[model samples]
Target: MPSVDEIRGRIEAALPGARVTVEDLTGGGDHFRCEIVSDRFRGLSRVERHKLVYAIFGDEIGGPIHALSLKTLAPEEAK
Candidate 1:
């Protein structure tokens, strides 16, 4: 079970301009929802947007973090 701070660190490290808000949706550490905003997401498709985030987790997507309901936005969309 990864802490929110650890998840935040990984996302921020992988995507320098990212702003992330993560919540444990099921009272457990596995199920989560995240709102992510990044300049790196600009012009990307919805699948691509999620893929960027998934790439960061690598094996953790199904190992530690079971589900991540995500809302990914470009920086301009965030504002």
Candidate 2:
């Protein structure tokens, strides 16, 4: 199981300057909710934006990370 900070690190690495937040949704590292805001999401569809984040975890998706819910946004879309 990955720690929340570890998950956040991976996302930060993958998106460089992205603003990312990862939470252990169920008090278990396997379940997470991630919010990411980045310039890279510009011009991409919602699914495409999610795929960018998912690509970073690759095989880990069904392994250490059992459930990952995402809120991906471009900087302008962020609150």
Candidate 3:
């Protein structure tokens, strides 16, 4: 299981300058909910934006990390 900070770090590393917030929803460190806002997401569809984030985890999504609920947005879409 990945820690919240570990997840946040990976996202931040993958998308530099992104504003990322990650939480361990289950307290067991497996389930996570993350909101990411970045210029990198601009012009991308919702699924595309999610794919960018999901790519950061790869096989971990269904392995150590059970679930990752994402709310990804471009800078202009954030409020």
1-79 per-residue lDDT for model 3 (tens digits): 7899999999999999999999899899999999999999999999999988889999998999999999998988899
lDDT: which is higher, 1 or 3? 3
Please, what are the lDDT tens digits per residue for candidate 2 over residues 11-63? 99989999998889998889999999999999999999988889999999999
lDDT of each: 0.89, 0.94, 0.92
Top candidate by TM-score: 3
Compare candidates 1 and 3 on TM-score and give the better one: 3
- Give one digit per residue, the lDDT tens place, for model 1 in 1-79: 9888888888889989689998888877898888999988999998999998999999999888999899999988986
Order of models, best lDDT first: 2, 3, 1
Query: All predictions: root-mean-square deviation over Cα?
Result: 1.1, 0.6, 0.5
What's each prediction's TM-score? Answer: 0.91, 0.96, 0.97
Error of 2 at 54 (Å): 0.5
Worst 10 residues of 2 by lDDT: 20-29
Sorting all predicted structures by TM-score, with the top scorer first, yields 3, 2, 1
